[model samples]
Target: MKHLLTLSISIFFITLFPSYSQDQSDNDFKEEVKRIEQLTIKSIKLRQQINPEAEQEALNDEIKTLDATLLKKVTLFLNEYGWKSKKEIGELANMGLFLAIQHSSTEEMESFKDIIERAYEADKIEENSYALYIDRLKVRNDLPQIFGTQYYFDEKSASLRFNEIEDFKNVNKRRKKVGLAKIEKYAKQNNIALD
Candidate 1:
């Protein structure tokens, strides 16, 4: 019985967290990430109305298609390579990886979280990216986030506001540990009311 139980638990973990293989070269990884970044940037620019309102529907559809493609690529990359350190893939590629994950569906966002944490464990995830990812998840789950990296418009204040924070008083300390700006500065930059 004990052996059976242990086996089941081991299989569960193995299924959820597949082993990583570094079969792809650093240059290849960088190039692929750049490709994903190009798609993401195009989608973002379209959303920002770089073109005309007449093109909005077609462009939004393009963004959706591009997002799906990027998500597939990102899932494959993560399953094979896991999350590489910034030292391994450079800052841009590292950020590119986060961008691909960030734009994924909420389920995908939650699913790839452990994979992304590999970079965080190595202390090499890019600046503020990890914080933002975590905060995004927390807010989505209706929980208080640690870092003030995710915000929404609060109707009460009639302005953008950081989501509720865990240990509000110590949030800056946590942010500092994770390479995020102080809560005050971040709030100010986002035009959120500290009061």
Candidate 2:
């Protein structure tokens, strides 16, 4: 009788715990659905009037809405298409239908690209390379802030630069660097180049 009771409890717990985990996953999926819906509505309303800067703004909002997992998906999709930076998404967006087709597998990305392309072609709008710029901003956020403003890898110089200042001295010298080694590790894991 004890053995039977123990078996029943174990089976019940195993079944119940898995269901709870599935429920959490479902909840996350639902939230993603809601976010996508909101973006879709915004895209539709802004479509005719959208500028490249405005479109970039929308992209930033979408990026913020994405969880880290979804960001990885976006990054993977970008890499799959051989994109290097945010500028690529913008350029592809300008290329019109081909870009849409290329990202057809990503529903929101496809839709957003279409809208941006249509707006750019219609309005002849040109904005700063916010997409490429945003990628740099994201990278900066991932690193220590002490790296200071405009810090970027000067691949040509083979040194990290803070602002226009190439020389890192004193505290600037202590700014932790993200070298090719780190980028390579990330690239290997994501099957994408860091550039």
In order, the Cα lDDT scores of the candidates are 0.75, 0.40
Estimate candidate 2's RMSD in Å: 17.8
Q: After superposition, how far is residue 43 of candidate 1 from its true place, in Å?
A: 4.8
Query: Per-residue lDDT for 91-142 in model 2, tens only?
Result: 3333322222222334444344544455344443233222322233434345
Q: RMSD for all candidates, in order, please.
A: 12.0, 17.8
Instruction: Quote the lDDT for 169 in model 1.
Output: 90
Weakest ten-residue segment in model 2 by summed lDDT:
174-183
Q: In model 1, what is the error at residue 68, expressed in angstroms?
A: 2.4
Runs in model 2 lying further than 4 Å from the true structure: 51-195
Q: Which digits, one per residue and each the tens of the lDDT, describe model 1 over residues 1-195?
A: 999999999998776664333333656676776775676666567567634214367767877787788778767777767776667756655666787788777888998888778777777676588888988888888899988788766666668766788889999888998788888998888687786
TM-score, candidate number 1: 0.70
